[model samples]
Target: MQMGIVRRSVGALLAVIVLLGAVPVGAAEKSAPRHSAQAIGKAERAMQEITAQAARETATAEMQDTRISSVMLHWTPYPAAVRYAVRVLRGSVGAPMKTIATMEYVYTTGLHLPLMAYGAVDDLYWTVQPLGYDGTPLAAASEPCPVREAEADPAAPALTTEYAAMPYAPLYPVYSWVPLAGQKEHEVEVYRREVGHDRYVHTLRGGEYDVYDDTPFTVPGTYVYRVRGVTAAGMPISNWSAYGSFTVAERTPIAALGDSITHGGGAITVPPSYQLYDWESYCTVPVKNLGRSGDTTEAMLERFERDVLPFAPRVLIIMGGVNDYRVGIYGAETVRNLAALREKCRAHGITPIFLTATPIRPALMTARMTINTPPSDWWAHRDYVNNWVMQQEHSIDVATVLSDADGELEEGYTTDGLHPDLTGKKYIGQTVDSYLRTHFAYASAEAERRVRMLKNMEKTS
Candidate 1:
């Protein structure tokens, strides 16, 4: 019945909007092979963009009594849209990003996705894309919007921090704590260890604050941290919590930024790629996993700054294109995306480590008739992408490493036809870990990290 409601609403909306033209762009803008535009005045294209800009999309979470039950996204009615497709993306907007829900447009209102879809996640991010009849995308997607809980958490609040550079606060490493419930003040413990090999040991007592802006870190090495609630009497109120690792003097770390394969997609165990504990979890070197499932090269590039570059790692591990191949992206175009990524990494002095796309079973590709690359031509396309990957000095030959006799995914390495199983992830992790040890030396500096990142900004007036 609910599904039928969506269909009826979409059908009614489409009937009315059959004549409207020009919609905003989304991820499709970066890599859509060709766009079929209705003949609208040049002003219409520009007007649509301005209207979308003038109309800010809003997000609010639903409260089931005291608990959050869902997140609702609201946008101004686009008279031209026959229907809208809402995409609920996860923490980051890169490869392996999942599409949690797809909803039809209701013009003047908001739509929601169940809170459970987020799976213990808070503050989910998303964007809305306009669609025509037959599910053809009508316009570019809107800018991403984040949904945060307006209600309070009754439980002892969980905490996480993000590292940001402050020109004003030069002496201290800035750890901006995420807002928490039931506490105005918080305590933090900061510690340093070997880059990747050792465990994070609590080494220092720090102040309770909305941010960790005081206390000089003084040391020049990789560091990990934990935070907890503090009582008014200057006592501990909660257990120290763990988030992903942070850096102090990150020894020229390398980050793997790709889709599901790099993200440890399918079933994950022992450790996830997110905690920087997946296959890349060895040798005392940190490999930040910036992977999001279902990300194309173009989408990964769009999120380069927010997800990949902020850590200022000296190297980047890149593996993408399978998602693009599904959309029938041409080999030359896909290579173009990788080449652009390489150039960006170079400008930032971050060496690019290219990885070949893992091969998938022909049967799987065939069964998914919707995919642009069919079984007959998929192998050839993979070879083409792999050939390009091999041209790079730091390339890891994963396609060969994970290919079976029939040239699909290797028998024991995958959870399914396309994604890697635990064994397969280990194999990739081993290859990446070994390569990093042999290639890059133990050397990094603040200047080295900043030099390339600064050049990324275009000189705008």
Candidate 2:
């Protein structure tokens, strides 16, 4: 039976060729007699049907093995390389997909590379998942597969901007912009202003990015920065992003503390007690202003035990004496008042930060009748007080000039001539805040307790 079946199949093939008139046509007729027109049409239709069935079967098999997804990389300046584990598709009938391999990766400046598992052809399905190198869990599902055709993976772009040098121990702010569709949970970048230069310094690649409260940038100078997203396909999205510029504060925190320009009038905020907003969007740390609109060093001394000392602040910023100058308190008396305040803070283990009085704007001082004290006298007394404060090395962290002998708010940072308006407040607050955040690592609860206890102690003192 098998021999007969094989012979029949061979015969069918031979018949198909002969029926198509492969031989030459009759000489006189100029054409050979083709198979009956009906027979030829029938055979042609049958062949088309068979070919269509085969194509459908092949398509079904291919479709069964195909799956879509993508991958993305976050670039940082940290020297360590990023690692990820891929959970591959697994199982024949009842099996489950599981992690099969891990990979090491590097980030280009603001660039993300998209990758594909080479083995996952149309014959097999795959899904790529991201995992921390050591399984510490940096991110999971950082990228997607079969990226959208119309829109490129938002992460495909590379970032570019001008260059600046980094400082010896620069602290950079980290940033990441992964959207909702990304598989990864968080991306981060660090940036800082360059010290002594008019530009920003940053590490090209950050090793690992944290999800919350990325580090604050401490580099100085003014410069621009740019960042972009990258998909895993290793395709570069050639687009430059906008730049964020910042100026490194010329005066250090100690300088700010001692500089009279940092002093504010009326209920000024104090340190160790941050007044962060409820939304946590802006600065809201408790600060003991101790800055009465017309208070002098003498007044501050009277209020120190009641107001300032109780906070038990790790750092104490003291800006006073303009009022003292107006009241004929200068030279020796001014020095004595400041010295007393210093002793009070130190007795409670607080580091006193002092600032020289900012210069009174000569033009504005004459224009605004609000000036009660002579600018010349105020300036002289300020000089004397600063000289005296500077002499106390242990009690004073810093005692420096805010402006020249003549007061002038640095270009855009000040709103008024004497008192710091909103902008000045923010600028001053940031400087003070930076110092406290760095030096005093104590928690809010502890800080608050210290403040409360100190205040109580003062009642008995």
* lDDT per residue as tens, model 1, 1-461: 33444454455445435534234456336534554333334345655554443332211112223355554455543322445787776665454556676565422123534565565545466678765424567677786666554222322333322232210112233332332333445666666565355554443344433342334333444455667777776576765666434433322256677876765423221112122224543323445556666689997887776666656777788999887765567677788889999888988888899989887764544453344444456666777888999999789887786787777787555423566655666677777767776777552233334423432321120
lDDT of 2 by residue, 329-362 (tens): 6667978887887787778776776655444444
Task: Give the distance in Å from residue 327's predicted Cα in candidate 2 to where it truly belongs.
Answer: 4.9
Model 2 misplaced regions, further than 4 Å? 1-286, 309-314, 326-328, 373-375, 393-416, 443-461
* lDDT score for residue 62 of model 2: 58
Residue-level lDDT for 193 in candidate 1: 60
